[model samples]
Target: LTRYDRMMARRRPKKGQAASKGYREAKKWRAKTYAKIARQRQDTGRKWAKKAVTDHDAIAVEDFRPKFLARSSMARKAADAAIGATKKALVEMGRKHGRDIRLVHPAHTTMDCASCGARTKHALPLSERTYTCTACKVVSPRDKNSARVMLVRAGLNPAGVEGVRPPGALLPEAA
Candidate 1:
């Protein structure tokens, strides 16, 4: 896509000049390719969302804009992954199924421990794939811990592999 973008820019006519037939064809091809990729992303997102909503009764998603990723070195990779699109699909699917969907704040998610509910003093770098809590000595994968944090912040169950909440747990009564 980047290569095609460059090619299209080069083929574009100068000021007051008409677009040549070859340039028009190239522009059409680029649009077609981009649309195809978008359709592919939508297809995969819907399928994944369906499976996720079917398997879980509740979901807690990190509420954050993915646009900032475009400024980082992983911009191209992040855009190709289509995380925002997939997340939108997931939320829509969850709503359609009448499942609980919570959007939790993303701050300090990776620094917090799932088991101990403790946060580290400093944020961990991306290279550090594991989270170790000094307060309770609980060690978990960074992504896994962040997921638990989201669940916790969303007031959902943060434990049990089968997505079951602890026995006798109840929601706080509204004031």
Candidate 2:
């Protein structure tokens, strides 16, 4: 879609010729494409939000501002993720289902030790999938550890949370 938009931009009609056939066709196509993408994004957001609200008694998500993220270098990817739409859907679903939905501050949630409450001294890059806390020696997947942190920030005990599997525990495969 971006490439198409760029290509069409170079061939856009001059000023005072906005009613040209080519310009009309390009404008229509652009509008249609944008609408299609929006529909797909909305559908996906609603489905995941409904699933999350239905499956979990409580949910703790990062309080992220999509508009701020969209100003970064990863604007295109951020926009494609549709963070605002997903968050809106989640909030709506939570309200409808009477489920607890906490939006914790996103700062250092991924870097802080969930077990020790100490932020890691060194920067953890995206390539580092495993998070090993130096202060407490608690090791787990980065995502799992971040989630545990969020749970704690939301004033919940991570151990008491249902369906929280132990780190590195093996599960039986479905037959």
Per-candidate TM equals 0.80, 0.82
- How many pairs in model 1 have backbone atoms within 3 A of each other, for residues 3 or more apart or on separate chains, i.e. clashes? 0
Clashes of 2: 0
Q: What is candidate 1's lDDT per residue for 1-175, written digit by digit as tens?
A: 6666777888999899999887887888889988988788888999999877786778898876665554565556557468777888899999999988888887888888888778799989999999889999988888988888888899987655434543444435631
Candidate 2 residue lDDT tens string, 54-160: 77778888887655544566456647469877988898899999999999998898899988899997879999999999888989999989999999999888989
Off by over 4 Å in 1: 68-81, 160-175
Model-by-model lDDT, in order? 0.81, 0.82
Candidate 2, residue 13: CA error in Å? 3.1
- Cα deviation of 165, candidate 2, in Å: 8.2
Error of 1 at 4 (Å): 1.9
Model 2's alpha-carbon lDDT is: 0.82
